[model samples]
Target: MAFTGIPFAALDFYEDLEADNSKVWWNAHKDVYDRSVKAPMAALAAVLEPEFGQAKLFRPYRDVRFSKDKTPYKAHQGAFVARGPSLGYYVQIDPAGLFVAGGFYGATTEGIARFREAVDTEVRGTELEGIVAAMQEAGFDIGGDQLKTKPRGYEADHPRIDLLRHKTLTVSRHFGSPPWLETPDAAVQVRDAWRNMAPLVEWAEQVLQ
Candidate 1:
């Protein structure tokens, strides 16, 4: 199917789900979920696969067995394209709006060690610094999990200590309820963000994956 746009009703569905995350609510409105939320998301992912590779739409059901919150359904609908072991591109439609992101998420311990080593090396480290700097300059928010303290061998004042402490890395941006999100231009916006993130994703794939 050709990519179109996320309907405004999709966002409304998620907002209502937040208030009533029970089987009764889901059963009553499943057609709306299928039509407004899942179909549009699948269409969007289908169009993105040519350049970014196949995308996986996350299932809405939440795994509550190990969690305390126990919400039955996810509050958002997200899609991911796994470019490498722990590296990927992602998009989502939520109550707030569309979110686009890409990078390494939950890379293995050994991979994180290699990431730190690469950051500790001046030649390679400066390349990453430049990538992050440019993304920030372009208004993307750089984020990831980090250690509270140093990564053992690195000095407290290392040039890229901040980058060195990352256990997982990602770059993301949110386009909050923009007019484009409710039209076919939504695909263009998502494509642009993913392309912008290619450098960072490629770097992590080489170093961490």
Candidate 2:
């Protein structure tokens, strides 16, 4: 099936699941989930695969073995386009809204070191600054965890201090339940958002490579 858009029922499923997150409830409503939520997401992924590369849907089951809150199922459905081994575009649909993001969200130790090195170099560092500025100007949110203090080798007043302190770097944008979300245009919105953030994704890929 061609990708139309996410129906309102998908959001409704998440809202309902948030309240009743139990094995029994989930098993009973599994068909609703498969039809209302997963199918649309799968179709959307299919539509995106041509331009973005192979698409993979995330499992809804949470890995709670290491966590405190042991919710059996995730309240949202997410998927990503795989451009290479490290980073690609991401999409999520949940009760709250839709989110589109890209870049390296969980960089390896080597990846982080490489990224910082790129940021510290004059030419690449200036290029990165401009990319980030363009993303912000386009209204996407810069994301990732950061160190409270300066990283070990970097000076406190480093020119790229803000980018230097980041453990992971990603660009994201959120959309509330807009009218277009209920139509085929939702996929268009996500595609445009990802396109808008492509420079950052490309930069991160090069830095991490």
Candidate 3:
């Protein structure tokens, strides 16, 4: 797939990243960053629009101290598709996903607990369940290792034991897609994941709009 038509402006984020890493390879090849990331993402986004609506490009940033091979920049690009709800997915251009993460988190303990509660209570039976089940089936865990903690007012054996157990799917860009499916499996996986998240998206849209 080619990003033959994706405007260069949509991927202007790379130039900033290059400026930030002026002493590294990123500054030297600012022009190719899109070819490596934004372009692939554009290709995927084009194919996903019919099923997922318009996908927006997310800027790439360099995590200067993130790893041993930290090159002062990320080689892949990402974006969220918001047809009915907001959902995120990324495309890797480099040998990455050495570190990849996604999930819902609150700025404080109370907010986190409330988010967990909302998932278990109000949103349990809706699309969220499908998201959780699909993620689990895909071999990713949500909420990280914090799932073991109990809410401040909850008991150890509360029915919401598994109730408050909201989780997110984590996929390494390195892993080859599982069997079945045509096209890049990442988009398909994300679509199935989004299916269960439409309701929540709709709710948020109502509040924001």
Q: Over the stretch 1-209, how does candidate 3's per-residue lDDT look in tens digits?
A: 73333333333444555346444656566566656455656776787678657767766566657567655555446565643222233333233221222333222454445455555554453445565565567665444334557655667776555545433223222333233222365555555555544444443333223
Ranking by TM-score: 1, 2, 3
- TM-score of candidate 3 against the unseen true structure: 0.54
Q: After superposition, how far is residue 115 of candidate 2 from its true place, in Å?
A: 0.7
Candidate 1 structure quality by residue, lDDT tens digits, 1-209: 66679988999999999999999999999999999899999999988889999999999999999999988999999999998886899999889988999998887779988999999999889999999999999999999999998889889999899998899989999998988787899999999999999999998988875
Question: Candidate 1: TM-score?
Answer: 0.97
Best by lDDT: 1
What lDDT score goes with residue 134 in model 3? 59
Which runs of model 3 end up more than 4 angstroms from their true locations? 1-24, 63-71, 82-93, 97-114, 119-131, 143-148, 162-174, 177-209
TM-score against native, each model? 0.97, 0.96, 0.54
Q: lDDT, candidate 2, residue 122?
A: 98
Q: Which ten residues in a row have the lowest lDDT in candidate 1?
A: 1-10
Candidate 2, run of 10 with poorest lDDT: 80-89
After TM-score superposition, the amount by which residue 166's alpha carbon in candidate 2 deviates from its true location, in angstroms, is: 0.8
